[model samples]
Target: MLNLPKEKVIFAGYATFFMISLTKTTNNRLKDKLKTKSYTTRGG
Candidate 1:
């Protein structure tokens, strides 16, 4: 009995996708920064 409108549901789906992508990218950037810092500390 899920009676939801089409456009609203689609919009919400897209919003969720964008949020997930943003989080993944943000995490990746943080990981890259940590790796860079570790390498620099070890190398120097």
Candidate 2:
């Protein structure tokens, strides 16, 4: 009962952070893929 509200609040906070973190992680993944492709093409 009481725990439900707290859980919801905590979930909301984490959800907000997750949205930002997800974008960062996605960008990092794309950068990593580009690096890999460049390295393969350059034979390095």
Candidate 3:
């Protein structure tokens, strides 16, 4: 019984970490896209 609860907690923590990292990665991609588009429009 103790092990079961511990396992669930670990899984939840890993899932949370994964989601946070994924969001950060997506945000970076969006930022890069916007920068490139702006540069191209500016003829830089």
Candidate 4:
């Protein structure tokens, strides 16, 4: 029973870390995509 809470805490920590990294990479990809789209629009 005592180990259960400890396991939950560890799981939550990893979840938070994974979410943060996922968002960071996705945000960068969005920015790059937008930049290229805008540049192409302006050039054409």
Ordered by lDDT, highest first, the candidates read 4, 3, 2, 1
| Backbone clash count, each prediction separately | 0, 0, 0, 0
Relative to the true structure, how large is the alpha-carbon lDDT of every model?
Answer: 0.94, 0.98, 0.99, 1.00
Number of the top lDDT candidate = 4
Candidate 4 overall lDDT versus native: 1.00
- Report the lDDT of model 4 for residue 32: 100
CA RMSD for every model? Answer: 3.2, 2.8, 1.1, 1.0
State the lDDT of candidate 4 residue by residue for 1-44, as single tens digits.
99999999999999999999999999999999999999999999
Instruction: Flag regions of model 2 displaced more than 4 Å.
Output: 1-12
Q: Candidate 1 vs candidate 3: which has greater lDDT?
A: 3
Residue-level lDDT of model 2, residues 1-44, one tens digit each, is 99999999999999999999999999999999999999999995
Q: How do the residues 1-44 of candidate 1 rate in per-residue lDDT, one tens digit apiece? A: 35567778998999999999999999999999999999999999
Ranking by TM-score: 3, 1, 4, 2
Instruction: Kindly list the per-residue Cα lDDT of model 3 for residues 1-44, writing each as its tens digit.
Output: 89999999999999999999999999999999999999999996
